[model samples]
Target chain A: MRVQAAIEVAAPPETIWELVSDPARYLHFMSGITRWEIAGEHARGLGARYRTLMRVGSAEIGGLVEIVECDAPRDLAWTSISGIDQRGRWRLREIGPGHLGERTRVELRLQYGVAGAGILGWIAEQVAAPAVRKNLRRSLQELRRQVEHEQARAAAATRRAAARN
Target chain B: MQAQTARASSGDGHAADGDPFARDFDEHEAGERPPAQPRRGPLERLVDAAATVIRGRVPAADLDERDPDFIRESLPAQWLLASLWFRGEVRGLGHVPEHGPVLLVGNHSGGNMTPDTLVFTLAFSTYFGVERRFYQLAHNLVLSWPGLGFLRKYGIVAASPDNAERALSSGAAVLVYPGGDHEVHRPSWERNRVSFDGRRGFVRLALEHDVPIVPVVAIGGQETALFLSRGEGLARRLMLDRLLRVKVLPISIAAPWGLNVGDGLGHIPLPAKITIEVLPAIHLREQFGAQPDVDEVYAHVTATMQETLDALAAERRLPIVG
Candidate 1:
């Protein structure tokens, strides 16, 4: 069984991508991202995997999530390895200009599989899916608040700079 | 777009209560949506066309994006204006769009189901060059009211999947509440702890129909005419809430900032100028190409809503919080 959740945030792709592209800030936005760090083996790029721990309710699972694709300010995807099955990705698009010039639509998507190789597995997935879905949305909303707040700070700084000049 | 739709593998539409898409009330309620007027004589068609033209020309009230006037004309201004005492300041006239279909999805509020929406529409009509209809995708219960013929006429459509899909595809900017009514009724005022479910139908429609999604956040909406309790069990059963389609405070209850009953509408709040921050657009990933996985589609859209909301909130109390 696979579960997914998503929302549109109102910051430009560049503004949002700056935060998502960085491995340093993953936990700041995602609620269940227990452990995350750049793998010394490779830089953040295609095929580069980052080992991280995630929580599904009380249970914890650790996995090496590899970046299957990475198109800055556009698309990013990852799949879990050596842990509870899961795959997630974030994609940003220029939906067109938003209400004020500052907002852009960024869609973040998360998907996970229960690895139900049998009936017992299926039963476990039934119990776990809803909780994970809620977690995914909560995580995404956090990402939105973080990114937009960061951008607003930048915008305010820019205005202040102009004022000083 | 096809790829994006395929990627959105959300496991929704399963439960009766959980999935808005699968929210099938009953045959009687389902019959409440629209099928448009039936075929008519050439003169009748001409009359309809002329009416559309006239409504298009009339100065409209600034309503919420999903106010439903996208399909028909029912912008209720004189009524709400007469009811509430609005004396708030307006500063961002330069921000609203001058033309075209605009989506006005603001913070869900205490101004009844579509009161603030109607207020927004009225303001848009007053300020913008052309009077535009702000279509609001309201809950099914509000649109299902009778005295509210004013309801159907003003284009307040149900928030069901099918109705929302139809409204947007027909060229209207569909306004939605991922947080739904629950967000407005949050018990504490310490900033809502909420996120939208994996309902990507609106995002898919925006991609499929190719309309821009604007993020609107209105401050002071929930605080006004406030109804804060999340009534449970017996209090709810006899609270006259369901019949009203909105929660109401007890007759004797007072508000936080020292308010009492016996006021004009009881919960009718003191006049306040609601400032709305209409943030920039969330450009649908142009590459999604019309059909992408549902998961991917949902991801892209949800992120934008979250980001926009935060930006609006941060910008709400500008000029220093002294």
Candidate 2:
């Protein structure tokens, strides 16, 4: 089953990219994720690995996933290496600077299927897809909130620095 | 006189407008105001008022009204004992999620008077604050005592499926000792062992609630008293199990009480200098398959706790002194 969600964050794409790329900070902004920790020495970008546990209904489904694609400030993707078979991607696009603020459209997509359960897998997916979509939406909303907050803080700090100078 | 008349007319108009009963009265002056819907009994009204007050004081769904105040008052003394006398060291508290429900599974030690339980409860309530809704599941007998209203106030509920479910549903971190009295009363020589008496209800609870299971491993509790035997056969012969739901009738050497049998009444717990290590959380469905085997989950949790306990034991050069 595939589930996706997007949000228009009032921040630059680079700001959203910085937050999403770091594995350590994933727990802070990811919804319905019970665990997301670095599984190996590599921390970020391609080749980095993470052990993730995502809550699906009354169960947590996840495994060791490795970064398969990393396009800085634009896109990042990962593929499952063991446990549950899955792929997840994060896409950020600049929606052009507006009079109100700079807006970035952030989209998260997850494609997952149980490796060995066959018909049971299909049934489980059918039951869990809606929940997964809701989780995705919540995750995106949290991401937007975090990115916007970070951007605002950064802008305020920059202004302070300029004033000090 | 004209202004007073106008004001009186307006007042009457406002009264008629505000009261629907008055409108009905005007429509049917003959019909008596529908008998004030049977007034609730005084006892029921008082009960409702008390419930409202309790709910306001204790916002958590399953917590007792006096829990926050009791924990605050007891924390200072418990902290002093934990830090100074017991030299209790807590680690990996960061592994606990900042929010949401979680199951804290640990091996229970130190017969009836568990210093480890006290130390952990103090540390947890201190770290998370009393408002975060944390409950410790204890045997029904523990909560049965009349004077232990203090225990209830500190969110110690009787270990039952219903109680556990209520705590979890309320998004409280529930600390459970699957070992129960059996492991706590094990011979002191077997202090390093992490035994749950093969209880797997904790795993089922975690799976049912879909919460992360954080294994809490503590050593030195068993060293508080010199446990001679579990006396399971004795308890069985005496029918204590059937009569009181008491599984273990432990014979232990302790201060004051030379030989303690069925230390359910509790004894003076020697300060054993407990060290608790909280292990990383394990999601059952994630580690194992979606339909994970209960035995497998139990084994995984106990093994992890055992390994950590062994490591902590290795660090202690002397018993009780640790």
* Weakest lDDT window of 10 consecutive positions for candidate 2 chain B: B1-10
Clashes of each: 73, 0
lDDT of 1 by residue, B1-322 (tens): 0000101011112122443444322222234333556767776566546544433332222233333222212212221341234422233433445444444444455433223454454444323311234455554334333343344444455455555555655555456664454444444252322234344455544555556666555444444544445443433454332222223332223244344322213244434444454566655555465455656755655565456546545665631120
Per-candidate DockQ versus the true complex? 0.01, 0.01
**Per-residue accuracy of model 2 over A1-165 as CA lDDT, tens digit each:** 888998899888887888899888888889878678897888998999987877554234576899999999999999987645689999999999887588889999999875444554566566668878998999898888777777789889999999999
Candidate 1, residue A157: Cα displacement in angstroms equals 40
- The CAPRI-style docking tier of model 1 reads incorrect
Model 2 reaches an interface RMSD of 19.7
lDDT (0 to 1) per candidate: 0.49, 0.72
Q: What ranges in model 1 sit over 4 Å off?
A: A1-165, B1-104, B111-115, B127-133, B191-199, B232-266, B287-322
Winning model by lDDT: 2
